[model samples]
Target: MSKTNLPNESIETYLIRRRALMRLGAMAGLGAALPGLRAQAQAKPATPLQFVGWQYNPQIVAQNVETFEQLYDENVNYQLIPGEYAPITETMLVAGKKFDMMYSEEATLARWITAGWAQDVDSMPDVAAIKASMVPVGVRNLSLPNGKLGGLPYYAGYGSFIYNEKHLDQAKLQPPTSWAEFLEQARQLKKDKIVEFPYVSAWAHQAPSFSWSLFSIWYSEGAKVFDANFDPVFDDKFTSVLEMHRTLYRERLVSPDIFTLPQEGVPSYATGQHTFAVIHDYDQKVLNDPKLSQCAGQVRNAIMPGATRSTFSWVSMYLMGAGAADPDRAWNLLRFFGGKAKDGQYHVIKRWALQFGLGTPYTEVMNDPEVAASFKSWKDTDVALQQLQNSTPRDVGKTLWYQDWDWYMMGAVQDYIRGSQPTSALVADLHKQVGVFKARYAT
Candidate 1:
C-alpha cells in the first residue's frame, strides 16, 4: 500500500503538507546561517598568559582584571596581582618559574640581568614592537652596560626641581639652570618668604631597589662613580654630591626629619610647608591628590639643576618575561599594557588606568590625539614632551650604577653631617652591614 495515499486522505493532511514545505524552507535558511555560527564556535581562545606586577592599588587590579579577561578569549583566564614591586623582582629572580610579564626600574633590571635572573629579551619576536612602542631614553639605554635589552619601557618621568610655582613667579625668578642657581634661588625664595624652607629632596623607601633619582641629580652634576673601564672611582664627584646635600641641609631648606621621611615629605610639601622639593616629573600628579595635598597643582616640575647632563632621569621599565609557555600570547599582553595599539579598547583602558596614576608607556598611545588632548588639559604638554626627549641614562654599574648605595648614603648622610659623624664612621657602620652585600654580591 502506498502511505502517501493514506496521508492525503484526511482533511488536515492538506494543511500538513503545506506546513512541511514551510518547515523545509526554514531548515534551509538555518543551514545558510550555520557556517558563521560554526566558525564562531570553532574559533580558538586567545592563549592563556600570566601577567604579574605590583598593582599600586588592589581595587584597580580587581576592576581591570574583569576587563582584561573579557578582552581575551573566554577560555583565556587573566589574573592581576597587586603587591609591592620588590616581590615581583624576587619572583623573577626565581629560576624557571614563568611570569608572562613583569616590571622593574633600570637598576633592578641591571642586577637581575647581571645575576642571571633575567633572560635575554632579544629572543622575543616583539623586540621591534617594543622598540617602536617605548621612548628612546626608556628602552635604548638597556644596551648600555649589559649589551642586552634588560626591560621593556614603561613610563619615564623627569627628575626636576619641584616647587611652589606661585612662589617662583612671585619672586620673578625662573627655574634654575644649575645647582648654584638652585641654591641661589633657594636663598632668594627663602628671603622673600615665598617658601618657609629652602629645598629638600626626600625619596620614597628603598624605592626602586635603589636611589637612581639622586643619581639623576648627580649625573646632571657631571659625576660618575666609575671610570670608562668600569673601575670604581668614587672620589671628587661623590664628595661633591654629598657636600651639596650638606649645603642644602645646613641652609635649613630641608627639615631635620627630611633625611628619614617615609612619605618623602609629600605630606609636608602638600601642606605648603616648603618652598621647593626635588621630585620626579610625575610628582605633580601624585602630590595633587585631593586627600593628600592642599597645594595641588601649585607644585610643578622643572629641569633638575645639574652640572652638565640635560636631565639625569630614572623611570619604571617593564619587560615581557621569559619562561612564558606562550611567548606570542605574552607579547600581546605586553603590547596591550604598553599601550601601543590604535584600538578603542586600548585607548579607553589606558585613559582609565592613568586616572589611577600609572602613566602610559607607548608613543602611539601617549601621543594619540585623544590621550594627548586630554593630557594637555593638565599641563603644558609640549613642554613635558620636550623634557622627556631631554633625558639622560643612569650609569648601571659603578657610581650612579645599579641599586641602592645612594639610598644608603642618603640615609647615612644625616648623622654624618649633623652629628659630626665622619664619612669613615658612616662607611664603617655600613662596612659591617651593607659592605658585605656590596663585596659578596656586587656584580
Candidate 2:
C-alpha cells in the first residue's frame, strides 16, 4: 500500500519529504519518552497489536479487547497513557514509536493526517458503505482534504445544559428557558445558599474544553464560531456571551475554580457543589450513576438556555497508525471496535452507548431500543436527543491549526474572566490573534 499525501502533494515526493523531516526531528516533542513499547518497527500476526489511550473507562476497554482476542484468536497489548493525549501521541509518532491504533479527537486527527502520522482509511474494506452509514457530522469529521476517511468514530456527543433538580426545587425555581432566566435562577440559588456557586464549566486551559464551553454558549445564542469559509465570526454575538460570563464570575454565581477544574467537574456536580453545567451530554450517565454520584437521581438535561436552543458537538475517533505493520489486521480491529464485530452487531459501540451513555454516530445504534432504554434510566431521552439534534460541531475546529489556536484562546479567555481586560479589548485581541494564526498556517 502507498502512503497517503496531502491533496496537492505527490505520494513519492511526500514520502521523501516526511522521511527527511522525521530524521531531523522537525516535530517538537510534547511528552517524555513513552515506556514499555516494543522496540520492533513492525509486527507479525503472532505479535500482539499495540493499543494506547488516555485513561477513562479502562475496565470496559480491557473487556472489549479481551472479547475481540477471544473471538478472533488474536492478541493485543493495550496500554493507558497518562496526560495530554494528542500532543503526546504526536511526540511518540515523531519519535518513531509504533502503535497499531489509538484514540484521537477530531482536530487532533486532522493535524495527524496533515503531519503524516495517521493512515487514511479510504482503502479499508467496505469503506464507502461504512462512510454512508454514519451521520453527516461523523462523515465530515473523518473526511480529509484529500477526500479520504481519516478514521472510524469512537464516540460523538454535544454539550448539554444540565441542572440539579434538587437545587431548583429548593430554590423554588424552574429550569431556565433563556440565558437571562438562568442567571436570575443562579442568583436566587446563591442568595438562598442552596449552592455557593450555582454554575460550573470545563474551562481548564490545559485542555481544549474552554472552547467547548464557549461554543455551547455562543451557539445557543445563534452564533457560529467560524463562517462558511472557516473565518472567525463569533464576535458578532460573543460580546454579550462574554459579559454573561463576566457577571457570573464577578457576582460569584459560578464556581470560583471554574478555570481550574477538570472536564465538567463531575465530582463537583455529583456531590452537589454546583447546580448547573454545560459539558458533554454523555456525562449525564456518570453523573446519574448511583455508585458514582451523590446527586444521581436529581441531575437532568434541558435544552441549552438561549434563543436558538443550540449547543456545540464534537466527535472523537479511533485512528490507525501510518506505520502499522499489518494493515489488514489493523483494519479488521478498527472495524470490529468502531463498527460491527464478527457477530454482526455493533458490539463495542453499543456497549459504550448502553454502559457509559456515550453517543454513537451510526443511525442503527442511535435508534437501538436497548440503548434508548438505557438512556431513559439516566436522562430525559426527548430533551437529550433534541439537544443532540440542535448541536453543530465548531467549524473553526476543523482547521489544522485549531489545537494551537485553542490553547492560545484559552489563555485569552482566562484573562478576560480574571477581569484583566474589558470585553471590547479582549475581542480585539482575539481577532488579531486569529489573523496571526491564519497567516502562520495560511488556512
Candidate 3:
C-alpha cells in the first residue's frame, strides 16, 4: 500500500508502528544502542497516574480527581502520593521511581529539564486552554521558559502583611502604609504594652511560610533573589533593610522567642500574644479559629509594606519535573492543577490540597461573594494577587534553596531582638553567612 493511502490506523497502532520503525533504525546503527532505544519506545501498563505532593489536602484531592477522571480518557488512572514539601521532592529525585506527575517549581525545573526528564506536551490543545484560564502573572511565573503555563497552580496565595488590628487600636496607632510606618506601629504597640512581646514572625520554623515572609520583605524593598541565571542574593536588601530588622530586634522591639520558638509561634500571633505579624495573605485561618486566636476580629490581612518596592509569593510556582515516566501524564496534572480544565470538577485536588488551608488560587472560587460572605475572617485572595502583580519576584540571588538560610537568618533576627546579639554584630555575621551561602549554594 502507498504510504499516502495507508488504511486508517488506531492511535495505539500508530504508536506501535512508530516504535518499530525507530527500533529498526537504531538496530541499523548498533545492536547495543538499539536496546536503550527500544526501552524508550516501549509502553508500560496503563495504570493510574501517580502524583506526590506536599500541598495535598483531602477535599482538594477529591475535587481535582473527580474532574480528572471525568475528563481523562479511559486509559488514564489517577493516584495521589502523600508527602510533605521538601522531603517529598528530595525523596522522589533520589529514589528514581515512576511517578507520572511531579509538581514542579521553575528554579528546580531548569535543572530537571536540563537533565532530559521533562516531556514536552506543548502541542497538547489543553495547554493553550489552561493558559487561557489563568491570570497574566500566573501565566508568566508558572509557564515554560517562564511563559507557557506548564503546571496548573493547584492552589496559590500571595505573601503579604497579616497584622493584628485590635492591638493597633489599643496602641492608639493607625494601620501602617509603608515599612517605616510598620515599624513605627510595632514600636508604639511595644512601648504601650499593648503586646508584651515585640512583633515575632517565627518564620524559619515554617520553611515555606518563612519564604513567604522573606519574599514579602525582599520584594517590598525591590530586591530579587533570581537573576537571569538564578543568582541568589543574600545581601541585596534596600539600604539598611537587613540592618533595620536587626535594629528592631536589638532594640528589643521585636520578639526574642522568634529565635527558637516552635513552628506555631508566629502564626499564633493572631491569637493576641504579639501585637503584629508579617505573613502570607491566605493564612488568615488564624483569625477565623475563634478558639485558637484572641485577635479574631482584630486580625487584618493587607498588602505587604513597601520600602523601595512591594512584593509577594505563592507557597510555590508549579513547574515541570526533570524525569517523568509519562511526560504527558505529568503535563496533564500540571494543566489540571494549574487550573486549565474548564470543568468545575477539575478544582477537586486544588480544593483538597487546600481542603483545610488558606490562600487558594481560584480567584473566582475564593472571591465568590458567597465564599467571602460565609467566612467573615476569610482574607481576600485578591490582596496576594495584587501584591505579587504590583511587585517583582523576590531576591534569592543565585539560588532558590533558602531552607537552611531562612532558619539561620530568622534565628539571627530573633537573637538580635532578644538582646542576645548586637545589631552591628548581627549584620556582620549575616554578611559573612551570606557569602558562605553564596559559595555553598549559588555558584
Candidate 4:
C-alpha cells in the first residue's frame, strides 16, 4: 500500500524544497549559530531513493540500509510488497508511478523490460565489473531478449528435493533417483510408518509456484512447453507429468492440505511430519532455522530425481526503474545492494547467504572458504549450486500471455488432482488452450 507520490509532485521534490525553506528560516532566526549550522547544511544531503520488492528479512533490510547510508550518505525508502510483486509493480507502472528501483524475477523480467518499465543496467559503466563478480547463470537469467541486462542479480534459486535425513536413514532408503523411484520410496515410507504423508506437492493455484511445481516434473523428463518457434507443444511426456502428480494423490502420499495451503511446501516440511518436499533452495534457510523448523539441521538436499537430474532455476534481481528521477543515485543504490560496498565487503546478499543458507549468485560469496566452513551441511549448498548448471532452458512466464496460460494450466491441475478429469482429457484441454493463447499473444 505504500507509494512514492502523486503525478503532480513527487515526495522527494516536496521534501527537498520544504527542508531548504526551513533551513533558511532557521539561519535567519539565529545568526550566531550560522557557522556550525552552515557546515552541517553544506554537507552532502541524503538523496531519497524509493525501492519496492518482495518482503525480506526486516533485520537484514535495516542492516543493509544502514551500511548503504554510511557508505553513500543516501536514504533508501524500501517498501516490501507482499504477495504477487509482478502484477502489483505492473499496475503501479501502468499508472505512471515512479520508483527508483524494484525487484523482479527471471520469469517477469522479459515482460517488464518489454513494457519499458525497467532500465537497461548494462549501459552503466560499473556493469562490467559487477557482471564479472556474478555467477554466470545469474547473468544469463537476467539478460533481456534483446541482449541488454534487465536487472542486477540479487539471489538465484534452483528447485531441489529436500528430505529429512533421519527419516530416510530410518527407512533404509537413499534419495530417489527417478520419478518411479521417488513414488516407490514415498509408498515404502508410508507402509513402514516412517511418515504418514511422505511427499508434499506445492499445488496452490498461483503464478510461478504452481507452474514451477509442474515444470520440475516436465523438465526432469526433458520436456518443454513451447518450441523455439513459440508454438505450444504438449506431447505425451507432459501428459505423463500431470499423471505423475495424480498418481501421488491417488496413492494418498501427498498432503490433502495442498489445495488450500497459502505458501509453498516448506511449511509442511518444517513440521517434521513430511519425509520429502520439492522446494526452492532458499527454503533450506527456513528449514534449517531452529526457531522456525522442528526438523532443523536434519534436512538435506538432492538434485530433483527423474530420467535426468533437471530442475527449475530462477533469479530475483534489482531492476532500476526507467522513470527514475536521478538515474545515477538509483544505479548506485542498486549496485550497493547487488554488489560490494565502498569498503569492498559484499552487503545484503552475502549476509543473507551466510546467516540463512539462502543461495547467492555471487561467485565470491559461494566460493568463500569461510562460507562453506560455517554451515552444518556444506554438501547441500554445493549440490544446489552444481545443479544450477542444469536449469530449465526457459521460464514458463516468459510469454506475455503467461497469466492466461497459467489460469488454464492451474485449473486443469486441480481438476486432475480432484478426479474431475482424467490425464488424457486434461492434456488435451491444456494443448488446446495453449494454441488459443499463442494465437492471441504470441508475436
Give the alpha carbon lDDT tens digit for every residue of 1-443 in model 1. 10112112331232233112123234223112212222333345544454555444323433444445457552223333323455544754563555566666665665555545445566666577666666777665654364566565556565655777778888998878777788898888877877657575654445531254566666777776445654445565656776666677677766666655533444556666566776655556645554446666777666666766455655566566556667667666665555443254563346443563334445766766767765654455665666667766665442223345555655665556566665556545644444544565645
lDDT of 1: 0.55
Between the candidate structures 3 and 4, which one is better when assessed by TM-score?
A: 4
lDDT of each: 0.55, 0.75, 0.52, 0.71
Total backbone collisions for each predicted model: 7, 0, 36, 0
Who is ahead in TM-score, 2 or 4? 2
- Over 192-288, each residue of candidate 4 has an lDDT whose tens digit, in order, gives 9988888885788875567777787788777776776556677877777788788888888887767665356555667788888887666666666
lDDT of 4: 0.71
Off by over 4 Å in 1: 1-48, 74-84, 87-97, 113-118, 141-146, 203-205, 208-210, 287-292, 341-349, 352-361, 397-401, 404-407, 421-439
For each candidate in turn, give its C-alpha RMSD to the true structure in angstroms: 19.6, 10.9, 15.3, 10.4
True-vs-predicted CA distance for residue 423, candidate 1, Å: 6.0
- Ten contiguous residues minimizing lDDT sum, candidate 2: 1-10
State the displacement of the C-alpha of residue 418, model 3, in Å, after optimal TM-score superposition: 7.0
Worst 10 residues of 3 by lDDT: 1-10
How many steric clashes does model 4 contain?
0
* Candidate scoring better on lDDT of 1 and 3: 1
Model 3, runs deviating above 4 Å: 1-46, 58-67, 70-84, 105-107, 119-121, 144-148, 225-239, 264-267, 315-331, 340-345, 349-357, 360-377, 380-385, 395-443
Q: Model 3 residue 108 lDDT?
A: 48
Pairs that collide, model 4: none
Q: Give the TM-score of candidate 1.
A: 0.74
